[model samples]
Target chain A: MTLVMAGAISHAPGITGREKMAPEDKKTRYYDACYRFRDHLWDQKPDALVLVSAEHFGNFFMDKMPTFCIGLADDYQGPIETEEFLNIPKTTIPGAPELARRIADVAMQEVDLGYSQEWSFDHGFMVPLAFLTPKWDLPIIPLNINCQVPPLAPLQRCHALGKALRKAIDAQPERIALIGCGGISHWPATPDSGKINEEWDRAFLEDFVANKTDRLLRYSNDEIYRDAGPGGQEVRTFITVAGAVEGHGGELWCYEAIPIFAVGCTVVNMDVAA
Target chain B: MSVYYLDKLMYQLNRDPMVQARYKEDREALLEEYRLTDEERQAVLDEDIGKLYSLGNQPQLLMHFAALVGYAWMDYIEAMRVGAEKYGEPQYQR
Candidate 1:
């Protein structure tokens, strides 16, 4: 039972230098919550982290996109683009290739998972890492879900893949923390792109904290697109995390509707060790 | 006019530094490689938010493309608003 803790969080680049654009109160609330989440991760003191996030055209393009891919590289680098705007220090983080390879192997054996030995993480992985572990010392296993492109894996499939991931994690010797990053609601480039659906975002967070994922898991991509915007598809990462922690409930650390970033940022920690 | 090509072009522009440099240096020649229609080509060249929106480019990609073309944050948002009005609401908005 080496799965020590698991959590989900939003990865808006705005979370980095929010004070530049956000109001004072909003900035304070967001940063305070971020520090709280960071503190929680430190409390866990896991030897390795399994980061689940989406690729923002930084690694895979439309030419060739995998539904689910695990990175098996010994090191990963990012904030791949938009470094200046994100204000994240440029550095490469060490990776857990041994664990990554095991996860890939388990997925292949259990669910026939797709994988890559070469993939550079984008903001989806880096932004959250910047806040959660600024030290950049934790060895990570970066897993990606194809949320940007259409014909994405259904919510059920994401859950199933997560279950497979859980099995892989259970086999590991090190204390592992699983962190799922992305989304409550946001429209990145559409006409109504910058709007955040606060009501929807809050409800989703409520359900997540309550561990009432039955409703959340049932949502179709079209329903999520209509309600939370296309970027809401990134919620699939959360769903995958929830799937990995099936039968467990978690605490909601924070939820904020930050329009400046056009995302409803949220943080939750599952009761993994219980 | 496949909306897919619009996405494809944006993907290439974002992922390939050479393509981005060429887009910045010689916009027309770089666009020639893609099978974009006249309107699409013009939209990319002009950095027309409305035309690109109407052409059905993905919002995320379109946003990054605008940034690469040197539009400031607010300016890019304004461009999308103007484009939506001029070209009709994007399907996502509807």
Candidate 2:
């Protein structure tokens, strides 16, 4: 009952100030859509926000990468060095450690999933939050999915993890808003880097808005990788949010293939049943 | 050998500003801490990104490495393409 709202947004660093250097029209389209998404999220007015995002070798490295991690600190610091690319003011966001602990406990106990308690957050969590809660007032529970490394959790597992998160949230007394921050398409470092798979991006968004959650989850990692590039693996974060809001449909708030960012930016507001 | 060591080196370079500064200051000494092979070290030193890609380095980390080595965005893409051609397709593409 505590899960009041759920949503997803693209967290391309370009969506930060980096997009301004792009073509004026592209910049306007991306910023306008982001503003609309931000306004809609602000209207939710939830007590806590649960953010699911990917780590870009920020917190963990190849030496010690966890498949998933949750922030358990009382307050979380935003990315410091990313200012050159993201240009967001460095600040700390409040953390819901108690709720985070509950979710971690549930994940560990029921699902046999081990998670790390780490506080560092990168652009994935900050970019959307910079827009959604610029003042950094809302208590946040950050959940990280391993999108950058190989042996990633399957989309099916991500959905199940979402369900487990919902169970954890249901146990909390505070009103919660879940935000999945990631992507639709675009490669970051490969030969195909900077290319947006418009066809795949539109199809994914269409399926999401039409409530084809199953279809969305059906795409294997290889399929997604081959079609949308390795960065597209981040969409598993969106799938996790969808799992948390099970049976609830979604409305596409905004979507654009911003070439400057090399990402198909998208935002969706989930319709949770009252 | 796994390409993981390359990723580890890149991660160290990306997360630690001091290491990055050191990389710019004394590339050889900083790289010594990492167990990179001679070819890997040479590729990094020469900024022969294509050679690094051929050596099984992950593109995600390579992208950051490219940025650190002063590659412009467009040039980074070109580097990856040229590397892919020279090094055969990346592991992911293969």
Candidate 3:
């Protein structure tokens, strides 16, 4: 059985390289929570961590949309600065071509799933890995979802797709854990721009961990706009995790609002029920 | 302004603290809490076109404000289109 753990967030200020944060205070609470989340994943000692996330123009463009993509490289590295991107060395771990084929086949029956041989790890995958791995032998499989485009998959579609991924992983017979990374609530424009929806953030975190997604998964873009804040757009990442963990039910591992990037960081642990 | 144009402008302005804060009273604190420099402070205050265009530290915000400006400028284009249709290009006929 695969142990699936995940989070939906912008960059937690304490973790993101964007700004400096004070230590030993509620202000640093997100960082404190991050450390605990890391310990939990490490304790699981799974054979590999399969991460699903969005890429910020790293492997795509406005010209085309690739619904699903897989990284088939021998190694992945990052946190690219203007001059250098921290590079790490590791086995690419097999891309699971058969599993990909099956998952893609299933998803296509429901929605579109694009397959790519080369996709790099962007911050969505890198940030959590930076903390979670801290240094480990297990490999990473990068799954990219197109949330930024006009023709984005519905929140419910992403969740169902994750359910497909669970079956795909089961077919592989490998010890695997899944991590969903993205957002809590963040505008990502000006540090001053995003309007953090405290009520929605708290509600989102609470509802997701409890595996109560019937309502969340149904929010159309129009409804999302009417009720959820603009930053609520990030909640799609959480929906995917809900699909992964909802079967067994998830426990809220941690939740924190880090103001640096105007992001909310949350970690969820699930012992998926068979 | 056309409703479509006004709606686009609203979306762009939505990313601005000036605009975002409009929805909530205490939004000013969120704006002030961030350590923005004096120049940025002034640029936002002035609604200076050049400063607005150049502000890239926050692409989402910068692009949003730029979009607002674009929407406003589009109104001028619309007016010109109406004039052209009425005057037939304002030709100098000998």
Candidate 4:
């Protein structure tokens, strides 16, 4: 078996934390899209889900941040925000250390990756997991890109990491699914929170689903900040996914800017099979 | 302002329950442990979400700390807005 499924989705904490605040129809549609994404993932019957996230200082700190990191543990705990804040209970999620180590060993051949034996899931990871694997039954391999801080990894490097990951996962015998979790264009957790640039989001998603590496890598940090806000930097996660599934275009499962969620809530199913 | 130390305090407060408990039980003592300036220390002591935001604190860290200090989602956003108005723009973006 090889890579069976690949995609990306929004992981705004407000999506879950402020669920009741959003309009009913909008929330329902967005959530339904997420549920469908989950079902589509399970249909692939993957042995592990490599959840790529832009961690918000839950485990990584400014003191020592890794540009890209993967968890190498038997189990991990999450929702570091608080059951009250994220509206998701703290719980343990299983990890596939064996598969993760193999992937890491193979991935390092092409890209530099920091690894940890211990990690606690922030909303970046928890928010998506809440919808994608509600039962917490699927084993996960958490991967993080430093989207919170600047002097960040270059977009090209993120794409390279994705290519390496694709190579590594393909070498493994187990079926694996990969999902990048991030906001498209919003100012999260800032005074400007709830502001979304739908135009910018759609443009990015267009390049993303098209697997147009050059276009996706074209965005400068300054331009991104000016148009999409800091949260838009998380596109690295999506870019990596696009790199992993190169030459394959994707279908837009959903895209909607939910203000309370502080992001253009999005879900894209990459054409891995194609 | 030492964004590093400010971030360190916030990182601990966000992830470590023991640190959160210590801050809750005896904040002044805990505040003294971090090499924070008077302004930073005071901001934490006051639970000033807006000032912290203006002081260049990371929004994610501030958001969690706001919750620890009893900020509802909207209140936290509003605090950042009000703080920006009072203290001027934040040194950092996001």
In order, the Cα lDDT scores of the candidates are: 0.79, 0.79, 0.54, 0.91
> What does candidate 1 score on TM?
0.94
lDDT of 2 by residue, A173-220 (tens): 878888898988888656665689999988888777665677978898
TM-score for the A-chain in each candidate structure: 0.95, 0.93, 0.82, 0.99
Instruction: State which candidate has the highest DockQ.
Output: 4
Model 4, A19-109: lDDT tens digits are 9899999999999999999999899988999999998888888789999999999999988877767899989999999999999999999
Writing each residue's lDDT as its tens digit, candidate 3 over B44-69 gives: 55544344334322233233344443
Off by over 4 Å in 3: A3-14, A22-24, A83-111, A223-231, B1-94
Specify the highest-lDDT model's number. 4
Kindly list the per-residue Cα lDDT of model 4 for residues B6-94, writing each as its tens digit. 88999998777899899889999998888888898899889999999999988888888898788887899899999999999887743
Per-residue lDDT tens digits for candidate 1, residues A1-274, read 7788788988876767444777677767767777897888778788888999986888777778888888888888776666776778778888988888876776666666667777666778888898877989999888888898778888888888878888888887888888899887898656564599999888887777666668768788888888998888998888888888887778877777778877877888887753
How big is the positional error of residue A218 in model 1, measured in Å on the Cα after superposition? 1.9
Sorted on DockQ, highest at the top, how do the candidates line up? 4, 2, 1, 3
- Please, what are the lDDT tens digits per residue for candidate 3 over residues A112-208? 5676766555556666776677664556766777655446677888888777777666655556677777766554433233345567768877777
Residue-level lDDT of model 2, residues B1-94, one tens digit each, is 5466777888778777888899889999888888888878888889888878778787767777887778876787787688778777756422
What are the TM values for chain B, all candidates? 0.87, 0.86, 0.38, 0.93
Name the runs in model 2 displaced over 4 angstroms: A107-109
Clashing pairs in 3: A8-A183, A9-A182, A9-A183, A74-A92, A189-B61, A248-A273
Task: List candidate 1 segments past 4 Å from native.
Answer: B91-94
Lowest summed lDDT across 10 adjacent residues in model 4 chain A is found at A77-86
User: What is the lDDT for A57 in model 1?
Assistant: 82
